[model samples]
Target: MKVAVLASGRGSNLQAMIAEWQEGTLPVEFVGVGSNNLDAMALTIAEKAGIPVRAFPRDNYNDKSEQETDILNWLEDIGTELLILAGYMLVLSPRFVRTAEYPIVNIHPALLPSFPGLHAQKQALDYGVKVSGCTVHYVDEGMDSGPIILQETVPVFDEDDEETLSARILKKEHIIYPEAIRLLANGKVKRDGRRVIIQRDS
Candidate 1:
C-alpha cells in the first residue's frame, strides 16, 4: 500500500510510523507527507526519510477550499492509497473529505464520542474522568466522528493535568496508529456502519 501522512505539529506519531516502516514491521510505502504549517516538524521528518513533502499553509491561499484543492491534487499526483492524519489540526472540509480518492484515518487523543475536537485531553481532565485514551478512526465530515478502527485506554489519576494526561494518551497513540495502518495495509479492516471489524488471520 502507498501511504501518505498529514500532520501539523511535532509529528511524533509520524516518527513512530516511519520507524516501524523502516524496520519492515509495517508493510507500506510512504509516498508523501503534507502539512498545513510550513515549519511543521513532520515535513522535516519526511525530508530526512527521503519522502516527498509539501506544505499548504492557509495564509498562502485565498480560501480553505483552494488550499484543500491543492492538497487533493498533490495527493493525486503522489498516488496515495491511504491517508493518515497525525496531529493534523485542520478540520477537513466536507467537500474535501467527500472528494478524496482514498480512505483517511486519524489518531485522536481521546476515546472519542465523549471528547471529540480540540483539547480532548483537557476535556477529559476537566470532566474528572477516571480513564482516558486514544482512538484511531476513519475521518468523516464531522469532527472526530467516524467509524473507529482501534482504541486503547489509560487510567486518569486525580493529580493528572492536561499535559500529563496528553502524554499518557500520546504513548498509546504511537502504538496504535501504526497498528491500525498495518491492519489497513493487510486488508484486515472491514467497515460495517459505524463499527470497524478486524479480520483475524487464519
Candidate 2:
C-alpha cells in the first residue's frame, strides 16, 4: 500500500511509523509527507528518510478550497492509497473528506468522543478523568468522530500534568497507530456505521 502522511510539529508518531516500515513490521510505502507549516519537523523527518515532502501553507492560499485543491493534486500525483494524519494540526475540509478516494486515518491523543479538538491532553486533565489514552480512527467530516479502529488506555495519575499525560499517551499512540495501518494495508478492516471490524483469516 502506498501511503502519504500529513503532520505538523514534532512527528514522533510519524517517526514510529517510519521505523515500523523500515523494520519490515508495517507493510506500506510512504510515498510522501505533507505539511501546512514549512518549518514542520515532520517535513524534515521525511526529507531525512528520502521521501518526497510538500508544504501547503494556508497563508499562501486565499481560501481553504484552494489549499485543499493543491493538496489533492499532490496526493493524486503521488498515487497515495492511504492518508495518515500523524499529529497534523489542520482540520480537513469537508469537501476534501468527501472527495478523497482513499481512507484517511488519524491518531488522537485522547480516547475520542470525550476530547476531540486542540489541547486534548489538557481537556482530559481538567476533566479529572482517572484514565486517558490514545485512539486511532478513520477521519470523517466530524472532528475525531469517525469509526474507531483501535484504542488503548493509560492510567492518569493525580500528579500528572498535561505534558506528562501527553507523553504517556503518545507512547500508546506509537504502538496502535502502526497496528491500525497494518490492518488497513492487509485488507482486514471493514466499517459498519460507526464501528470498525478487524477481520482475521477464517
Candidate 3:
C-alpha cells in the first residue's frame, strides 16, 4: 500500500516506518510527507529516504481546507491509498475525513482514552500511574478516540520523569506502529462501528 505521512516534529516515528519499508518488513511505500510547519524535521527525514515532500506556510495558507485540498490532490497524484499520521498535529477537516475510506492511522504516545493530546507522558506521570503505553489507531474526528489497531505497554518507573517515561514509551511505539502497518497492509483489521476487528489471517 502507498502511504503518506504527516508530521510536525522530529519524526522518530517516521524513521521507524521508513526503516521498515527499506527492510522489506512493511509492504508499503512512502508516497509523501506533509507538514503544517516548514521547519518540521519530517521533511528532511523523508528527503533522506528519497520520499516526496511538501510543506506549507501555516499563516499564509488561505485556509486549512484549501491546503488540505491541495494535499489530497498531491497524494492522489502519487496514488497514495492510505494515510499514516505519524505526528501530524492538525485536526483534519471533514473534507479529507469523508473521503478517506482507506486507512488513516495515528500513533499516540500513551494508551488512548487515557492521556490524549499533548504531553501524554507527562499526563501519565502527573496522574501517578504505574504503567503507560503507546497506541496505533485509525484517525477519526475525535482526538485519539479511533479504533485501536495495536498497543504496547511500558512500566512507568518510580524514578521516571516526563522525559524518562516518554523515552520508554517511544521505544515500544517503534515496534507497534510498524506492526499496525503490517496488519493493515495485510487486511487484518476491519472497522465495525467504533471497533477495529483484528481479522483472522488465513
Candidate 4:
C-alpha cells in the first residue's frame, strides 16, 4: 500500500513505521508525511528518510469541503492508498473521511473504549488502572472512535507514573502499528461495520 502519514507532534510511531519499511519487515511504501504543524518532527524524519512531505494548517480552509478537496488532490498527486494518523491531532473533515476511497488508520496510546482523546496516558494513570495499552483502529468521522484494527496490552505497574506507563505503551505501539500495516498490506484484514476481522496469516 502507498501511505501518507499525518501527525501533529514529534512522531515516534512514525519513526517506527519508517524503520520497519526500511528493514522490509513491513511491505509498504510511505509516499509522504503531512502535518498541521510545519515544524513537526514527523516531517523532519520523513525528509531525512528521503520521503516527501506537506505541512498545512487546518485553518487554511474556509470550508470543510475545500479542505477535503485539497487533501484529496494531494493524495492523488502522491498516489496514496492509505492515510495513517500517527499522532495527528486534527479531527478529520467528514468529506476527507468519506472520500479517501481507501483505508484510514490511526494509532491511539491507550486500549480504546477505555481511554481516548488527548492525554490518554494521563487519564489511564489517574484512574489507577492495572493495565494500559495501545490501540490501532480505523479512523471514522468521530474522534478516536472507530473500527478496531489490532491491540496489544501492557501492564501498568504499581510504581508506574503517566510518563513511565506511556513509555511502556509506546514500545508496544512500535510493534503493533507496523504489524497492523502489514496485515492490511497482505490482505489479512476484512472490515464489517465497526469491526475488523483479521484473517490468520498462513
Candidate 5:
C-alpha cells in the first residue's frame, strides 16, 4: 500500500510507522507527509526518511475548502492509497472527508466514544475514568466518531494527570497505529457499518 500522513505536531506516531517500515514489519510505502503547520516536526521526520513532504498552512489559503482541495490534489498526484492522520489538529471539513479518494485513519489518545475532540487526555482525567487508552479508527465526517479498528487500555491511577495519562496512552498509540495500518495493508480488516472486523489468520 502507498500511504500518506497528515500531522500538525511532533510526529512520534509517524516516526514509529517509519521505524516499523524500515524494519520490514509494515508493508507499505510512505508516499508523502502533509502538514498544516509549516514547522511541524512530522515534515522533518519525513524528510529524514526521504519521503516527500508538503505544507498546506491555513494562512496560505482563503478558505478551508481551497486548502483541502489542494491537499486532495497533492494526494492524488502522489498516488496515495491510504491516508493516516497522526496528530493532525485541523478538523477536516465534511467536504474534505467526503472528497478524499482513499480510506483515512487516525489515532486518538483516548478510548473514543468517551472523548472525541481535542484535549482528550484532559477530558479523561477530569472525568475520573478508571482506565484511559488509545484508539485507532476510520475517519468520518464527525470528529473521532468513526468505526474503531483497534483499541488498547491502560490503567488510570488516582494521581494521574493529563500529562501522565497522555504519556501512557501515547505508548499504546505507537504500538497500535502501525499495527492498524498493517492490518489494512494486508486485507485483514473489514468494515460493517460502525464496527470494524479484523480477520484472524488461519
Candidate 6:
C-alpha cells in the first residue's frame, strides 16, 4: 500500500508511525507527508526520514475548495492509496472527504463520541471521566464520528491534570494508531454502517 500522512503541529503520532515503518511492522510504503502549516514539525520529520514532503498553505488559496483541490492534486500525483491524519489540526472539507480515493484514518486523543474536537484532554478532565483513552477511526463528514478501528483506555488518576492525562493517553495512541494501519494494510478492516469489523487473517 502506498500511504501519505497529513499532520499539523508536532507530529508525535507521525513519529510513532515512522517507528512502526522502521521496524517493518506496518506494511505500506509512505509516499509523502503533507501539512497545512509551513513550519509544521511533521514536514521536518518527513525530511529527516528522506520522505517527500509538501506544505499547502490555506492562506494562499482564496477558498476552501481551491485548497482542497491543491491537496487532492498532490495526493494524486504521489498515488497515495491511504491518507492518515496524525494530529492534523484542520477539519477536512466535506467535498474533500467524499472525493478521497481511499479510506482516511485519524487518531484522536480521547475516546471518540466523548471528546470529539480540540482540547480533548481538557474535555475529559472537565467531564470528570474516571477513564479516558484514545481512538483510531476512519474520517467522515462528522467530527470524530466515523467508524472506529481501534481504541485503548487509560485510567485517570485522582491527582492527574490535563497534561498528565494526555501523556498517558498518548502512549496508547502511539500503539493503536500503527496497529490500525497494520489492519488496514492487511485487508482486515470492514465497515458495515457505522461499525468496523477487523477480520483476522486466516
> Would you list the C-alpha lDDT of every candidate in the order shown?
0.94, 0.93, 0.86, 0.88, 0.94, 0.92
Q: Give the per-residue lDDT digits (tens) of candidate 6, residues 26-135.
A: 89999999999999999999899889999988899998799889999999999999999987888998899999988999998888889889899999999899999999
Worst 10 residues of 2 by lDDT: 193-202
**Model 2 superposed RMSD (Cα):** 1.1
TM-score of each: 0.98, 0.97, 0.93, 0.93, 0.98, 0.97
Please provide, for model 2 over 140-192, each residue's C-alpha lDDT reduced to its tens digit, 9 standing for 90 to 100. Answer: 99988998999999999999999999989998999999999999999999999
Q: Across residues 39-85, which tens digit of lDDT does each residue of candidate 3 receive?
A: 99999999999999998667766888888887778778888889888
TM match of model 2 to true structure: 0.97
Counted clashes in each candidate structure: 0, 0, 0, 0, 0, 0
Error of 3 at 123 (Å): 1.2
Worst 10 residues of 1 by lDDT: 109-118
- State each model's C-alpha RMSD to the native: 0.8, 1.1, 1.6, 1.7, 0.7, 1.1
Q: Itemize residue pairs with steric clashes in candidate 1.
A: none
lDDT of 1 by residue, 100-185 (tens): 98999998899888899889999998888999899999999999999999999999998898988888888888899999999999
User: Which rank order by lDDT, best down to worst?
Assistant: 5, 1, 2, 6, 4, 3
Q: Give residue 26's error in model 2 in angstroms.
A: 1.0
> Which lDDT tens digits does candidate 5 get at residues 52-73?
9999999999998899999999
Considering only N, C-alpha and C atoms within 3 Å, which residue pairs clash in candidate 3?
Answer: none
